[model samples]
Target: MNGPTRRGDLFDDVDGARRFTGPTTGDERRMLIDVLRAQRSTLRLKCSGLGPELSLRSAEPSALSLLGLVRHLADVERRWFRQVLAGQDAPPLFSSTTDPDGDFDGATDDPQVVAAAWEAWRTEVAFAEQFVTGAPGLDIEGEDSWRGTVSLRWVLIHMIEEYARHNGHADLLRERIDGAIGL
Candidate 1:
């Protein structure tokens, strides 16, 4: 892997991250899947090589943190893929009815908390990948309370949007934490 930026610089070398390996040419489904994976990889790269600082609420007044983003993305993966797409009953791993923000609110500088966040995120991500792979096609539809009938294609697109939006926030938070920037 390549090294980070030089001192006092905000722009890190893009090649250093190598988080975007998506093919420059592919069909719609393949392209979407690859872009989404690259977004996921970008999130991971933004949070890499951090210690307890991952839990630092650099955004202030909001419970946003690198660890929180990890946990929240895990919940998102579970909701859209397992519950909505696969018709499973998997509930939020880090949030609840009375604690909808538990994923972010509970983010702390504990080793176990950090470990659990990453584990849950990875598990949900793996399940989502499998579900998408085994899916007959993106046309497969599911009912969501918020969006009514939603297709796997729509879910994949929404997930890409979600990650892209959060990755932007992550960029700011990360820069605040360690002056690291660029993705």
Candidate 2:
């Protein structure tokens, strides 16, 4: 397949990292989904090159790693989309009541672990997408014990915020792992 093009300082479509050219005319749902997809793509780009070993390497003294972030995002996706939104009985993919931080703490330099994280993340994302696609509208409500009734719009916004925040951490982690940095 053809590779990415470098135009000036920007690398167009490099490593599957699509630039986020905000939607100007779409409806609210479309715009929100587009923005969320862009953020997800940014995270993928940030974690692209490093293998499992490097993926598990903490940028600082803490247990924050690229693989851990992937796993954590997967859990977040499942919680909000499948559990909270769709009302599915989805349990945590990596974390649990006994080991709540397992997603991050269990991250390791194993290829299997890295692969599983990606798999889980992709699976949850697909489920989320399907849930959103089938929803009647953004106003549809979901039950959450902690937050009580929540609209799909609220969930989408929260997810976007969540991804944006973690993507910032991914940027720092990627920079520390290597000198690579970009949009």
Candidate 3:
């Protein structure tokens, strides 16, 4: 693998790049958010600069692509943060109960699709951050009808795990698209 991949001209230096960084020192909440942020950044870095067509193309035999991952993550963020945690009735960002895999199935080569995926992902991330920031503590509970009550800490850890797992798929998908690899 190449030494930390870089997006040419888009970032000035390693510091400016969207690379993962663990928390140096902080409380559990701060550390959790830091880890989650790093994972999110890793996903963005993995998807950067591959044009729209390549972004949508699945690695043969598997119906998975970076574009699909982006849309899927957006849906996940909206589901967990906005709907379950914030108790908002936000509709699914890219999928529905009828067509549950719409996020991946509907991923297309159009640049608009890629742009929309990123927009929705960023929007959900912002809303999640805002909600977490305003919450009293990590121990605060949220009602998930299917999963019963869950705490903010559980959600944060789950989000981190979600990103980490998808990022692994992204690593393979990205490598298949272009030879780029590494954190």
Candidate 4:
């Protein structure tokens, strides 16, 4: 309640700070990227003013915490963009087959854990952004073992969906943590 949420948190004016313009009209690629960027910024906004509370779980049966969401999304980003799309051997930073829920289950209320989650999320996001920027076109195809064949467009839409869904959960978790709420 006294100082900025953390050392470098700039959620005071998330839109102004992050430059997340939710542009409604543009080419398909630009629009998709902008929307995804907006969704990503929304996640940051939802978690902006908290430190340890990022690890607060919602209910007894659910391991759904804001920190968990961050970690899980980090894994998701790595899986989709790095492994599936870019054909990199990037294993998830948090989860493994033996413990698929490690992202959520390991979301301890420790500063180090929170920092790692944010770092991994940001790194994966950066890679995804760069991949999108460098791609020849949205029609570029990638072979996904599960989905068979996926295009950049499909991946972008899926990432947007993933973030949007998790951001909704983030909204609730943030409100539960401190009664602060907003889109």
TM-score of predicted structure 1: 0.91
- The prediction achieving the highest TM-score against the true structure is 1
Q: Model 1 over residues 4-106: C-alpha lDDT tens digits?
A: 8555445464644665676778677888888899899888878878979999996559999999999999999999999998999999999999999999999
lDDT of 1: 0.89
Residue lDDT tens for model 2, 51-107: 865455554578888888999999999999999888899999899999998999988
TM-score per candidate: 0.91, 0.88, 0.87, 0.90
Best by lDDT: 1
User: Which residue pairs clash in candidate 3?
Assistant: none
What TM-score would candidate 2 get against the native?
A: 0.88
**In candidate 4, which residue pairs clash?**
none
Badly placed stretches (over 4 Å) of model 4 are: 1-20
> Cα deviation in Å at residue 77, candidate 2?
0.3
- Local distance difference test, candidate 4: 0.88
Instruction: Give the CA lDDT, 0 to 100, for residue 50 in model 1.
Output: 90
Residue 37, candidate 1: C-alpha displacement in angstroms: 0.5
Instruction: Output the better candidate (3/4) by lDDT.
Output: 4
Query: Looking at candidate 3, what is the lDDT of residue 145?
Result: 74
